[model samples]
Target: MRIERLWIPEKPSVGKDIVQALIRTKRAKVLNAKSAATDGYFSLDTGDVVCPLFGHMLTMLPPAAYLTKEQNAGNYFEFLPLIPQPFKFEPKPDVDAKGKAHPPKRFNLIGELSKRAGQIVNACDIDREGQLIFDEMFLYWGLDPAGNRFLRAKITSKAETDLDRSVTALEKNGAEHWVRQRMAANARQVMDWLLGMNGSMAYQQLTGIKTMSVGRVQSPVLAMVVLRDLAIQTFKPQTYFVPVVTLADGTALRWEKRKDAAGTAGFDAAGRLIDKSLASGMVGAIKAGARGTVAVASTKVERESPPLPFSMGRLQATASKQHGLSVEQVTKAAQNLYEKHKAITYVGTDCEYLPSAMHADAGAVVAQLASVFPGKCAKADPGRKSRAFNDEKVDEHFAIIPTGLVPALSDAEYAERAVYETVVVRYLAQFYPAYEYEKTSLVVMYGPDEFRASARRDLVLGWRELEKPESTETEEAPANGPSRPLPKLEVGQQLAATGVSLETGQTKPPSRYDEASLMEDMISAYKFAKTERDRELLQETQGIGTSRTRGPILQNLLKRGFLLSTKKGKRHEITSTPFGKETIGRLPPWLTDVATTAKWELMLSAIALGEAEMQSVIESQIQYVKTVIERARMQVSPRQSAANEKGAGAAKKAA
Candidate 1:
């Protein structure tokens, strides 16, 4: 069953490894020098050709070079957007002012291969981004599938078994619907280009700044920082006192009040009383072992739902919160699992649910894990219909999970293994029994005051056997560790306090966002939208950026001085600088609004889903670009500039 040619990833190391696996799976033979060939590489026995491509050999043209002379003269772009019919693209090599390309030789090589191959296999990774990468090469060569036969070999992992399975399951696509993905990717790239190319030039010229970089996604992020820091600056600290009483067992209770007068900052979100005098007087009346009555006690057993599998955002948050790994670090770890170890599915997806159709494959994968995690494995019900495998929630690819190719962890890097294990535990947890716990509560009455104490005991470890929770905040921890199980309790029983104290504290400013929380905010950014309809638009659009690009955007913001990070102990605190704030202050709502970009992004997504035509989305953006140009042209008045100059002149005379 040997094919005439086999195409795979372009990296020599990866290509060589994949070729070896294909040889085993199909007994394919190599005909070339086995040396990487530019145009003539072939499979010897069957006359098949194997080729790999680095992604997107051709890209949208850059600003100065992209526009024609008349357009560059600021005539066309100033009034109208440059809408290339079919949207032109060129090789993304270093370009001179005249648009000359100095591309890597491989770009031309792929173009040549596109012309020769009769049966061109789209053996790219199984994601829209991957489809765009390989499809763009053929598109740039003007080689339509109408003339050449096309096949798609899509798989989420480089693992041998998954790769072999994909080889057999290849789909024939003479219609080139796979290239529809290229439409979505290109629309996004062009959308960014339109915003950046026009917005940056307009801003730099208007503000008299030598250089300014603005973006559809980047500008909104800048505003997030600016608004947060402004709130921090203007926030007034409120003073409050919390009543604390120590019990006979050295356990302390913080007085909890559900409600108070509306004007009182009563019991902050963490439930601390706002009345200082009342708290102080209550504390004064109490001694170390003050007698009180336990008015009521209750206990119940409940089962907690298993966690959904890891999406990039959840994984980033988990790693950051549990292990102090930065979002960048966690991303690299996930990449390692996909690329080097080949232990997991694709890592760049935002979807956290599996396709229901993959139940058999998931079951097979879990069966392989029995030896590795025997205790938890015994509890797994891989074939069960659960929340993790819901087709309605799936898009492009399923959640990141083990691909059944277990790696030797003894030789793996610590960070890589940590991320891999995190994914594995999360994946397995979905199939295991639900975690059951007994929660008990007791309330003590002191005159009119009441204090509640609660304790929880694991009745059944269940999925918790593999997925243990990490405590980050005090509120997240068991009521003061409840270090001991609650002693047998009875209603109306007398209880005593050993000591009492009044602790006065000031409300702290909202802390700067770290990567994990930032990722959460970016995903849930619809919460920041100005209107209900805009919020729904953002929610449907998956917020401001894709999983693959958001982290890099934040890193770029830090590099460009739009945001600053300071290490406080193990965790970093991030905030915006003065320049970042000023930039946001001067920008118009269209540029800085998250909902604005989200509205446009939703249209791009609709284009991808084929719900809306690409032309309409492009036309809408064109109108937005016109507004940007107008804003850039309308600068502050000359009289205001001259008045400032005159004031400076007067100040100098006085000096």
Candidate 2:
């Protein structure tokens, strides 16, 4: 009898491991899913030749025209982007150490196996790139699309249980319309490739630099930092005085100046307090033991819901803040936890909610963890519906969480353990009760000025047993400083103003972007948009780069010397280099704007969803590039010349 096969996309040995894991969990019978490594290469006998494709079996290549242009351009490779495109793909190389081109063994093996197998079931990772990786090979290997079936494996973790579950729940006959995903990935890859190369060329041509590395996502991020730095550089510090009064109860409050006070006919646009004299006069009056009655004081109990579970972007930011790890570092640790430790589920997801189908299993995992941790989930009700398990929120992948496989990490790195613990705690805290607290605000009358005092009192430990708001998180009222529990105060209570003061301070420029803040900014870039539609598009798309791509993009930027990194205590501060600033300055707004890039990403998504055609998006993208270059050439040439002339004049003057 002919045996059936369930081929997957792991390396040869790794494929064997998957089969073994399946067998261990009794998800697959040991006799049927035996390992076969007789030829020094491994495969699984899962009633068939279940094998691994390693990674990508074929490599995507630029068009022949672009290749010719790139080869001939030599040192001036930047101009190669100016060429038109008809992207090409060729089989990736695979050979032993004898300097022999043995051809791709996996590709050939797949071809050989496809002939015997009735259906080609794609058991690769459930992602666009993963779809492309396997589909490209199958198509190239001459497998018919009708016969080729896709079974997307949603492997949350590499644990035996997860793989068993993922393989068991594998949707037959490509239920997700996964081929469209391949189309989307192809469009994205080609689009980014074209944009980066072309954008870099335009920058090099405009700035007279031989080389630059600008991209759809990268240039905008660089612009964000550089523009911020420019804002800091050009900002003229304005001296302002805030009149503050302290009560006899040691309650300090700032005097409210709704409109400008007397001696100021009009307010200064830059400075809040145009008349320091008025503030001085008020301070003198208060120092003479000014007595005032409480104006409006209020207290209310507030319930702060537990934070949404960790999306990849959120996880990256949290890890960067909590452990002082770089985004790339956090991403690597996360990948390891999912792939190696089998502790956490799909780490690349942007979603904070689990799929409705997985809620039962996820709740079971939580219950198991609760038993292990003891008392942490005391208030947690697994049966209770929560925000963590929302069907609408789950997209291609679910949130990162423990897969009920408690990782038996023997000697993991401190940072790795820290990241894993972070994910675990985040998941644990999701089940706990909402953190309850009481907030009190007191407003007192000191002449015409109203002084405000606010305090936060903890009402319940709640979910805070597992998670607490970061100390570094921005407060609603930073000027008031930290919060403390307040004593009882009535609205009509009389209070003595012990002293008054005028605090002199200069306005601060926006803080520099650290990995944490930068990640947040990148994720929330849509919030900065001028319009609602732009914001909506961005929110849906999750801003520029995807969860898997941002870390690598940042790494590429740092590697290419476009940005400089400096360590400030625990945080790594990212600053734009002179070249970076120049690149952003030289690019047109359409190219440098994050919203514009986000639109392109969003368009690709629309294509994937059948809302838009792929060819139309690509054509529009090509036209957009041409337009950007045409417009930028005009703006950049004059500026570059002016800068050069200015530099020459300065040299002459020095001489």
- Per-prediction TM-score: 0.79, 0.83
Clashing residue pairs in all predictions, respectively, total 12, 1
lDDT of candidate 1 over 234-260, digit per residue (tens): 998988776777777766666655444
State which candidate has the highest lDDT. 1
- Candidate 1 TM-score, C-alpha based: 0.79
- C-alpha RMSD of candidate 2: 6.2
What is the C-alpha lDDT profile of model 2 across 130-184, one tens digit per residue?
7777777666756544243545565556767667666667655345467677778
lDDT of each: 0.71, 0.70
